[model samples]
Target: MSVDDFKHRGRRKMLVDLLRTKGIEDEKVLEAINLVPRHLFLDSAFIEYAYKDEAFPIAAGQTISHPFTVAFQTQLLDIHPNEKVLEIGTGSGYQTAVLVGLGAEVFTIERQKDLFDFSKIMLKKINFEPRYQTYGDGYKGLPSFAPFDKIIVTAGAPEIPNELLNQLKVGGIMVIPVGEESQQMLVIIKLSENQYEHYEFGNFKFVPMLERRDK
Candidate 1:
């Protein structure tokens, strides 16, 4: 049975409220979070706690990110309508759905075949169509579609990849986490061809960004 009903909406509203209390001030981000049925992105076993601000395991040993983490990173991006967004890790595609709801032209990538397939099915089912998605290396952000208005890496990178920086449009922003075990959420703004600005938010834990395609 479809769970995207009244109860789910209520939970989402409460989740948004919690995000607000936790310092997510962006109305657009909150609205997008409210509209997306986060429950639909989890396994049936985790459905009960899907609305809670916690990460839960999905397929391929990956976990869906906490709602707060999603909101925080999204707020940092300062997304504008019709902006082209390169999402490094599609995971459950929950973030991609939120990005599309925020009016971005999203291009997402996922390495795990199971997750790539799952996100494809779920996104199509919900009508959250990103402009493009592929199974590839996140380290080499979509060079063919370079100059993206924004780029978001959903996993924790040990070091910033220069390729992703190159893919970002001049003056564009990229929100990523850098570290091992735990990460510091970093918001990077490409100032010029070789210059960039960065700000580190607090720490967060995400599935480690793996190397190459997981075939």
Candidate 2:
């Protein structure tokens, strides 16, 4: 096969593996992951490996998370078709695109200026740019758009921010990876006033969440 044909087939195979083998069975999320061109989200130098279920470095010493991570994180959000969601880390906009494709009205924030710029452009390129209320500091959830039905933090935090918890509506859910040296991902579900439940899923390493002093 020609080089171009080989790459196309490889991407298709990757998609199948993600759905059938990786346990990403949500039809909506799977379809979105397949529809959004992963190659377009990576640097031209890494485009050939874009479809692989792996992480790749981007600017700002950050990496676009693995595709399985994206699917799992998104699935944990339990998004409703028209729910408003807040994403703390935009990264490469791959996760943002998936959220939008799942029919959630997303309000995403990115602290790193270069990453913010890149994600904005890439999201627009795929016509998947969400409600995009970018901020430099993700520690403070988008309070102005508070009462988000769901909030997802892509970066790992030492602890859940009070502001983020306050932003969630009663009976809402927030998926975050929290830790200092090691990370444990969990889903926090708000039961009602002064009541919340937490479930630990698994352990994973991720870029530490940083506070943007200038934001």
Candidate 3:
């Protein structure tokens, strides 16, 4: 490995350590976070800060989520190998890459066309192939690919969308942030055919989950 590659690996290890200190205890989630190079998903200008547990602006006014947020959400999902997972936002594709690394069959959607296109290229370049990388409204979810084992929403929604709940398989989990401009509640829902359970994990801030595509 080159000097830069070695440095990046060291930074990833440090990042994993930080995540552990912050309560991210899922070994699989930590492994995936370390394996996927977060810097590659960021703009070159912000590459140096890639491993920090912080969010950064990306194209289409979106931001790549903080590492802690990503790890937190992924850990909540409790992903299993080859399980079908629906991701509501594909901004920067960093989270998608981590999910892919964790052995989930990822189907991710982005509302902004620019981010959709950019993330597709970035994920492909990194050899992180999601089952589907779509450009569409996240609120709609992906009906055709319904009944996912898990669902993750990267943006903050005003409320949980019924469409997403409908797409989740019975006993599946969905992690989302729900609120307006300020702090949002990190919600986890475990769905059954006729009933669902909700768990709130305190506050987190995310870009608003917009409806329709930005043309």
Q: Model 2, 71-178: lDDT tens per residue?
A: 888888887798999999998788998899888999999998888988898788668989865857899878888999999999989998888999999989999999
For 50-99, candidate 1 gives per-residue lDDT tens digits of 89999999999998999999999999999889999999999989999999
Q: Candidate 3, which segments miss by more than 4 Å at Cα?
A: 1-4, 212-215
Q: Please tell me which model should have the higher lDDT, number 1 or number 3.
A: 1
- Give the better candidate number (1 or 3) by TM-score: 1
Evaluated at residue 7, the lDDT of candidate 3 is 84
Over the full model, what C-alpha lDDT does candidate 1 score relative to the true structure?
0.92
Each candidate: what lDDT? Answer: 0.92, 0.84, 0.88
Model 2 scores what on Cα lDDT? 0.84
lDDT order, best first, reads 1, 3, 2
TM value for model 2: 0.92
Clashing pairs for predicted structure model 3, backbone only: none
| Model 1 stretches with alpha carbons more than 4 Å out | 213-215
Show model 2 residue runs off by greater than 4 Å: 1-13
- Return the number of clashes found in candidate 3: 0
Top model by lDDT, which number?
1
- Name the candidate, 2 or 3, with the larger TM-score value: 3
Worst 10 residues of 3 by lDDT: 182-191
